[model samples]
Structure formats: C-alpha cells, structure tokens
Target: MTTPGHLYLVPAPLDFGCAVQSPLTDALPDATLRAAAGITHWICENAKSARAYLKRIDAIHPLATTIQAQNIVELPREVHKKGDHHGGFDARPLLAAALQGHDVGLLSEAGMPAVADPGSSVVRAAHDLGLAVKPLVGPVSLLLALAASGLNGQNFAFVGYLPQDATERTDRIRALESIALRTGQTQLFIETPYRNAALLQALVASLQPNARLSVSWGLTLPDGRTRSADVKTWKRTPAGPDNQTPAVFAIGR
Candidate 1:
C-alpha cells in the first residue's frame, strides 16, 4: 500500500496587497517556513499570488524546487467568489499530488488557509481521502483582532463579510450586535480594503450606543493598529480605517 503524503496548511503573511509588507520571519515560525519550503506541490487560491509568495519564501528558506519547476494548481475562481466551506466544491482532484506520495501545500493569499479563506474544501477533502492534515503556526487576522479587541474572546464568531447593500448591511450589523449584546459572544467580520470606511460608518450607525466596536487594520505591519471603543465614542471620532488596508471588525457588549 502506498503511503499518502500529508497536506500542509501554509499560511501567507497578512501583508498581501498592502502598502507595506511584514517580514515572513516576523510573523511565521521557523518550522512553518521550513515545512513550506520543502513542499513542491501546492493547491492555492491564486497561482500567481502563490508563486509570488513562494518567491518570497525562497528568498529566506530556499524552496525545494525552483519556482518554475513547482507544481502549483489554483483553486477555481468560482470558489473564490462563492466560498467552498459549504462542501459544494469537490477538492479531491486537487490532492492528486498528495495521493501519489508528494507532499502538498495549501495556501491562501493572506492569513491561514480555510479560516475566513477559501481552502476549507481542500482541507475537508484531505480528511475524507485519509490524507493527514497539518495546520502550521502563523498569524490569523481574526484571532489577532479578537485578542486585541478586549472583547469576549472566550466565545466569539467570525461571521465573514457583511452585506454590501446599505439597508441590508445595516440590518445585518444590527442582528449581529443583538446576538453580541444578548449573549456576550464577540461578533467578528471583515471588509474589502476599499469598503472599510463605509462599513465602519454603517457599523457605527447601526450598533447600539453602548456596544463595543473594535477595528483592526494593517495587522503585522509596522503601522498595524487596533482601535476599540463604544459606538458613542466611535461616533464622536468619526475617522476609521482608511480605504487602502485590510481591516478586521468586531462588536460586543
């Protein structure tokens, strides 16, 4: 019987597409970098970004295979738009390399793969296929934001992105706030860098006056900052995350 290779969940730095990037060594453990360096096959969100990330890794750890020789497969674009967490996407095909006894890396553009990211299907498929799944130590923005928020980290939920439509977004924020207020569960979500300020406005306008709001941006970068305050305080200071950087938003009592 052939031994199947393990699937390594390789996390990329949080600085993807940001104005400033943090050193990988600063955010990722040596073991993770070494493990990622040894994998020659990958199933990634975007092949181009994956290559770019690999190039960065090569600078420090020296990839086992040259960038051109790496067998990199991108997850379908549809999976990027409509998430793969619901099990609708079949990811076993992507794991052919691993089935053949070649270790494979699963990467997202930023943070951990499958957490607030699109690679859950691949990880789920690995488990179903009897492949060992290993998640490496790395920075996960949601957890970082939650830890810094001073909110109820004991019980929190990452609700992904909020609705884009004005009324719907406000309504959604209110619903999330209701749960946070009533149960002390921290509500976490994110917004595209460009829509960040707008979402902050909607969040401020919708959450109860006493509800705590935490906005974390530029995480892991030199300019990284997390601001937490009640809705009233946030309203008093209307400035929020600028439109150029990734941000994580959280609300709770």
Candidate 2:
C-alpha cells in the first residue's frame, strides 16, 4: 500500500477568537481531513497554544498520544538549526515529520505559518517528501497592521527587521523614510519590544515632518491600539516616555 501523505499547513485567521474578532479555529479545514480516518493526529508548531485554541471550541486534540505519548514521528530541531536555513528555522519546532498514513498539522504561534515565522522548514520538507501541504485563510500580522494602519497597502513591502548597529540602523531607517516619502510605498517594519520606544523616537525625528505614520500596537488583543497621525504630531506628543509596547510601525507619504 502506498504511504499516506504527511501534513496540513492550516492558517488561523490573523485576529481570531475575540469578542469582536473572527474565530479561525472553528473554520480550520479539519472536515476534509476527518473523512480519512484511521487515527486522526495533529502536530502543531506550538503544542501549548494549539491545545488551548482547540479547547476553546470544544475540540480535543490527541496531544498525549501524539507528541505526548511519543507515539508519532517527530521532526528534530537539530536538522533545521544546523541545516541550510540555520537559526531562521529555530522557531519552527517540527522539521521532517514522517508519513504514517495519517495527517499532521503545521501551525504558527499566531496567524499563519511560514509567512513571517519559522514554519517554512516544515512546509519545504513536506514538499520534498511528496506530502500534501494545504492552507486556509489565517490571521496575519502584516496585513492586519497594514489594513488598520490605513496606509497605501496596495503597494507595500514588509521589511522584516532593521540593522543591529545604531548608526547602520539609523541609515536604514533614513532609506526607508525616503522610499515612503518619494514613492508613496508604505514601508512597514518591526523591532524588538524593548527597542520600540527608541524606534518610535527615531521615526518621529527622521521621518518627514508631514509624512503619515501609523503605529499599530497590541493589535487584536484586549489592549489593542492603533495610532495614526503625522510624524510632526507624534514628535510633539509625550507618548513614548518608554512606550516599550509590541507594535507594527508604518511610514508613508
């Protein structure tokens, strides 16, 4: 008998499961999967959150029998940590899941995997192993921030991170500012939470006084807040006396 396919890459709606947020857990494409039943198994990127998310909807996953009971095959982290992508795959827990005529699920800490997280290794490995990788609509921080930012999302790029060195980072910021001002292309970037205040200060100082700036902080959470205004106004405001909050900052003309 031919070996069964391996896994599914399901996208959890970006901001799912809130009072006003759309829940993706209820919508995960599990029905199509349930059709083939020998023993249903799931291997989640974040074992902890996956359990909680499913439990919220009266769905109980076989955590003990799978990763817990040590019954199913596991993808070691060493393969990715020492592999081609290097530390980029560190965040991705499962690397090379084995096929057992059962289906596995590759997920992310939030939203979809492989978009901005380390789940790419699992997806790539599944392809190499000739496994079926399927995905559904999921919440993504990138698009969420852009949509709420109200910037020119039509033409935008997610420049993942900035340089480490202060001077180099400052130069990169200047370059991004110039691009946003000249081309009207929304420049979006993220930074470590600790450096958010510093980054905000730099943005207020470097970006054109009249340039539009939107800082989407704590999105899709109880304290979710979005601040959009001109750089000049942001500079004058006494908001960041240490505004070390998790946020996505966007700058554009």
- Best-performing candidate as measured by TM-score: 1
Please give the CA lDDT of all the candidate structures: 0.93, 0.62
How many Å off is the CA of 59 in candidate 1? 1.2
Candidate 2 on 49-81: residue-level lDDT in tens?
665544433333333243333323333555324
Residue 240, candidate 2: how far off, in angstroms? 6.2
Over the stretch 95-139, how does candidate 1's per-residue lDDT look in tens digits? Answer: 999999999999999999999999999999999999999999999
> How many pairs of residues collide in each model?
0, 8
Q: Against the hidden true structure, what lDDT does model 1 obtain?
A: 0.93
**TM-score of candidate 2 versus the correct structure, residues matched by position:** 0.72
Predict model 2's lDDT versus the native. Answer: 0.62
C-alpha positional error of residue 52 in candidate 2 after TM-score superposition, expressed in Å: 4.7
